[model samples]
Target: MALGWKLVVDAGDPHRQAAFWAEALGYQIEDNSTLIERLLAAGTVEQSLCVEFQGRLFWRDAAAVRHPDDPFDPVSGTGLGRRLLFNRVPEPKAGKNRLHVDVHADRGQRDATVARLRAHGATLVRHVKEPGGEWSVLTDPEGNEFCVS
Candidate 1:
């Protein structure tokens, strides 16, 4: 049996975080507006539970980014594979991340990639050089750490 899962990160501003990650990973921000509109029209969900962002309706506390090629539900726009869900949290990131994502780049592309990420609000934490290889640790806009190599 196979179990399916999506990576979830806590964020102070989920929509903003989703946008950042979407650009960083070349992913698409899931657009659930159609379903949200349907629910709103049918009175199934409260308007207060949703928000208007970039002229689209989104769940107030969460947003997601998905691999551009992944399968997704047409009605809900929910990705069926390789997704990252960002949910709002009351507090900011407090300490080091227990789990982090590593982004691999082609040989000699690490510096360019790191620079690009920096332009997208990722701050370089430090560079690690070891016998195995080299990678740069960076913190996203919300301070979650990831590595680029």
Candidate 2:
């Protein structure tokens, strides 16, 4: 049987991380209005724990971004497959990341992509030329690392 998966990331601010990664990957951030409403009505979550996301309600501490063509359930406003979930954490990042995303840019667009990401609060950590090719290592606004090639 075919299985589905999501890339889950831990961060201090999932909403911010989701926004940054959505823009970086050209993906759409998921809307969790149904979940939010249910939680609010059940008193499982406080209003302060929610945020207005893209003009809709979502959990303030977590967000999911997905490929545009991926399957999703509109009734729950949840992505059914192929998504990236960013969840909040209390501790600060202390060491290197065990996993990171790599972005592929067309030739001559690499530099421009790097600049654009920097404009969006990403920091350029360094550049590397590996046997495969050249790429830039960058960190998001909250310091999660990703590579652009």
Candidate 3:
């Protein structure tokens, strides 16, 4: 049998990271507020565990984004398919990411993609041109490194 998984990333601000990745990947931010409201109303979850952003409630320390076409639990808005979860951490990113996402672009779209990402708060670390091909290395707003090729 095979196992399923979701990628999890540590962040200083999970909500912000969710928004960034959602836009970057054309994904939707998961909306778990319906379940949260029910839990809060039933006194199953404390108010302190939730935070309101843009008038929507979310788990205080975590947020997630999901592929738009993926199946998900409607009531909880939890993705059942490909997803990325971001959780808050007290410490900042210390070094390079051991695993990083690579954004693939069409054959000639690399520069335009890099420019768009830069406008969206990605910092260009450098451009690499090896025997394989070229790619632009970038760091997300919170300093997690990724690449565009």
Best by TM-score: 1
Summarize candidate 2's per-residue lDDT along 1-149 as a digit string, tens digits: 97778899998988888999889888889988887899899999899989886788988888999988988988777888778999989998888899999989887899999998999889999999989889999999988899999
Better of 1 and 2 by lDDT: 1
> Which regions of candidate 3 are displaced past 4 Å?
none
lDDT of 3 at 87: 96
lDDT of 3 by residue, 52-84 (tens): 975899999999999999999998999999999
lDDT score at residue 97, model 1, on the 0-100 scale? 98
Q: Scored by CA lDDT, what does every candidate get? A: 0.95, 0.89, 0.93
* Global lDDT of model 3: 0.93
Steric overlap count per candidate:
0, 0, 0
Candidate 1 vs 3: which has more TM-score: 1
Model 2 spans with C-alpha error above 4 angstroms: 38-48
- For 39-123, candidate 1 gives per-residue lDDT tens digits of 9999999999999887899999999999999899999999999999999999999989999999987899999999999999999
